[model samples]
Target: MAKTVLITGTSSGIGLAAAVGAARAGWHAVATMRDTGRADALLEAAREAGVADRVQVKRLDVTDAASVATCVSEVVAEHGHLDAIVNNAGAGFVGTIEQHGMEQVRSVMEVNFFGVVELTRVALPHLRASGGRVITVTSIGGVVGQPFNESYCAAKFAVEGFMESLAPVAASTGVQVAVVEPGAVTSEFVNNVRLDVPAMLAQAGPYAPALRGYVDHALKSFGSDNAQTSEQAAAPVVDALTADRMPFRIQTSDWARDFVAVKLTDLDGSAVQTEMTGWLG
Candidate 1:
């Protein structure tokens, strides 16, 4: 039987790539985006990849509980069983902590963190029945905080913490939970981030030139000048699902690998803390 995998946020980026990758690997891919009306490109990509027959596009809005329930139900009904779900829907929000209101931060978390939690909660029963896996896309920023992106980092951290807690419980149930932390990958992510700050707090201001420099440096450091595209970054994630041995976490890029290695191997925590201070500033 072809394994059935449902993925969220497939309108573009890693989600779309993962869906196509799964289909190419002989799995049934139920791909979803916030609005199916805008998914012509995703469909076209699937067709170009020669996996259109195995890809099913659906409407899904992770922040909406009703939408999550309806989409999951529809996928399960169509596929009979869901072998995996990749929670790949999220965006970045950039602004100083004081300039960006808590409301804006909450909105970020609603979609990036709480939304995935809700979806996983609703999909648990079906997943447990089929002994499936839950894979979430986090970022290096989640493990190490950064300036001007507190909300985005917070949401990813929340996701990391949530999945870490769930992993132990799922171990006993034969269900697996893991996270993919990618450094940068070429996608629409940068163009999509919301910048909520007053003109007075503009990054380009003379008074805040130092702050502006730091922010620019971090953004550039996200991925290589010639970083992997969404399709390339999807390889490790797809590997995680089909691998003979499951890993609790997978970092998709070389930068991500080095960052996570330093994060995990830093027994003193001093080196990592030093690296984090620059971003926190």
Candidate 2:
């Protein structure tokens, strides 16, 4: 009678680690990704952790409503109940407002914001039935916007607001909600962005200098020793899934906690602006 938890984007990074972590904690982890072809690493990790039997791989593309519905339905039908869901599927975008097309901006929103809403919408009834919880892996950028990441930050901002607003309402129905914010983690998330520096720099009209500076700063930060490991970041997520009292907001590491605190305490917004300005060199 182990509880079930469905997690999206488990091909690598935090989602991969969270899936294995949940299985280790005795929850049946439904590890899902947009493409099952990329599941070898997750499967290997599960086997190494001795939790392979508890981790099930499934296909779930958050951007597709049908896929979301089918995945949730299958999990509930097979497990008889779904005790929790981890919305960890997301994409990274880098560029200023005018440099990118509207389609690009919309695409970012569709995956990062709307996708979470769609999956959560379809899973709420079952979550209520099982008194389940919702755990979303957002970024520190969601709280404090960064330069050259206007679109990505906007999408994450939207998610933070949506979840913050839905938390109280969900609690009334015996379902808990929480958002896990990770500053920077060593993972494939950055690689997945697929940035072509030379081409991008050549095309940068007025924003090239800023983009260059931001890219340099970002590369250093991601490669720095301060960045958390995927397992370290996913630890808080599993805690949220199983803790006795889950908070509405959870930071995966001390660095993330400190970074987010700037926004929470900023009264005039000058503090966050001042900090981000440095990223542009």
Candidates' C-alpha lDDT? 0.82, 0.93
- Residue-pair clashes, model 2: 0
Clashing pairs in 1: none
Question: Which lDDT tens digits does candidate 2 get at residues 4-86?
Answer: 99999999999999999999999999999999999999999999999999999999999999999999999988999999999
Q: Against the true structure, whose TM-score is highest?
A: 2
Ten consecutive residues with minimal summed lDDT in candidate 1? 194-203
lDDT of 1 by residue, 1-281 (tens): 99998899888888888998989999999998988997888899989999899999988899989999999999888879998889999977776666658998999999999989998999888889988999998888778776666798999999999999999898788889989988777645456663333443564354365455555565565454646788878888789779765788888877688887887888888878787666534
How high is each candidate's TM-score? 0.91, 0.98
Provide the lowest-lDDT 10-residue window in model 2.
185-194
